[model samples]
Target: MPSEPNTYPGYRFPAEVIHHATWLYHLFRLSLRDIELILAERGVVVSHESIRRWCLRFGTDFAAKLRKRRPKPDDTWHMDEVYLKINGELFYLWRAVDQHGVVLDILVQERRNAAAAKRFFKCRLAGLKYEPRRIVTDGLRSYGVAQREVLPGVQHRTSRYLNNRAENSHRLTRRRERQMQRFKSPEQAQRFLSAHAMIYGHFRPRQHLITADQYRRSRNKAFRTWWQETCVPMLA
Candidate 1:
């Protein structure tokens, strides 16, 4: 039998498997079964059930590691929500982005009302150490209420077209969701999407949807940093 591949420090599964699982979760938006099939094509013998177990066991810890390695978001934040389907039921996924279009955080909830919105702001938004100077969001009154309570003095804008930046950010998440055949539950959606948000924020080129020069430079730097820091192991 071939020798089993090694893993990262204190991890059980091969680091290659964990890395592949993480990439599959974000870039391709594949479920455990889909990831199993994909790896099988590459001659890695693994079961869908095993993939699921690996995700549940190590997914959150891997996400936490990525977050710890990421830089802080810009000072200005834009918030928005996109519709998500879970077990054929509808929900809203609240996402926040900084001025440069870097994703900051995401919250999955059943409602877009004041209560849900308040929880998003109070819980997810509050956790950020880099308190934004200004916040841009849609003309939702819930946002106003949350801002009044949580970020009282911060400048808040509620214009229609002004929030297009955030609205556009939702498209990427929507694309990823479609690939996964939708989430199974709100909890699953939240956990998976949070990891997605971090991965997206890390690798996305600046102004990718627009300018090329900036995109090229930003993408090169982002990938270079990721390769150096993530792919190469640090000395103990």
Candidate 2:
């Protein structure tokens, strides 16, 4: 039952300020300067650099807590890879999502070959209690080759048309990429995205499938859960 202030010792700003700034940076296409401006508007003077540091320090911690709270991902995994232009170099971002559109894992790699696919498969499969019932992916020969090698028994359906669930998951990363003027490095992209996917998905509920009131309730619940996980420890 510890509050954020109690836990974050020696920090100048309160836990709320740090958490809010991190939230704004990830949940929107806003830049660090934009976040600083917003906080200043509320009479909370903090530099953009400070906000960035806060995100780098605390974003992953919050995201880990949120991920721990997620239900076990569905058995059907949709996998896809997209090329990301970073520092004039092309890197493929491999992402896997469940049928419910929950991001299961993400990896930034230099190649989109069978070896890269195998690496992603191992990373995503780690810690899961059960192998997926099926995996859906685009018509990539690499995926087929890796599947046969790493997941011989799991059913894999390879089709560009059937993998919308995973392909669409990349939109958020694309939006952030443009806003940030493309990622500076693979390590930076991986760190930010590892936290970004979890935190953003924690707040975003499937609104189109529910009524307005239901959506509102879900939204409220999401925020409440965020506050508990990021700003305070939840009691058992």
Candidate 3:
């Protein structure tokens, strides 16, 4: 992996503090004001608006670093689309996850038709750098239509019950939507959800499949990776 950038020359706060606040915001369901209050308790007097700016500026960089550290996704991809309300306008949020529940890619679009599905499929294929062996979806004919165009030879399964992994992955997004009261625009929703997926996917493991000791080890490793990715080292 490439080395993280060493300096935030113009920023008044240390990179450690800035990145920590960003991590807290995305890793947990905390609002900007909530982060400000938490920092106040720690004797850091930064404003909520600053926290928001830090997230907007550096969230994607942190997420990109985390994505580099992730393992290659599984070949069986599960795809789903959910409707998001922005300014009382309905938009489609398309997401795909691997069998292990790692998010592959996400896109926000105005429709859920074949064109939208094809765009989403192309996005995932380009981002992940390969086609999946099998793609599963919740009986969406658009998925079938798109797959035939973009991934003609890949296996496509359409079933309501087989795509629970992708459906369940939306729980966090739903919580965040409720907390934010709804997104203001399509661009904002896309940016936030893309970064959110990478950060959340980094820390989330299949807890039910692992023993306690293994789970603890996994959690610790995730924290260590987060620290390395986000913090610049102090001078000697």
Q: Pick the candidate with the highest TM-score.
A: 3
Alpha carbon lDDT of each predicted model:
0.75, 0.89, 0.90
Candidate 2 global CA lDDT score: 0.89
Residues 42-140 of candidate 3 have per-residue lDDT tens digits of 998999999999999899899989988888888899999999989888999999999977788899999999999999988887755677899999988
Clashes of each: 0, 0, 0
Q: Which of candidates 2 and 3 reaches a greater lDDT?
A: 3
Ten-residue region with minimum lDDT total, candidate 2: 2-11
The regions of model 3 sitting more than 4 angstroms off are: 1-7, 234-236
**Could you give candidate 2's per-residue lDDT for residues 120-166 as a string of tens digits?**
99998887778898999998889989889988999999888889998
Instruction: Sort the candidates on TM-score, descending order.
Output: 3, 2, 1
Candidate 3: which pairs clash?
Answer: none
Per lDDT, the best of the predicted structures is 3
Cα error, residue 230 of model 1, in Å, equals: 6.7
Locate the minimum summed-lDDT window of 10 residues in model 3: 227-236
Q: After superposition, how far is residue 145 of candidate 2 from its true place, in Å?
A: 2.0
Clashing pairs in 2: none
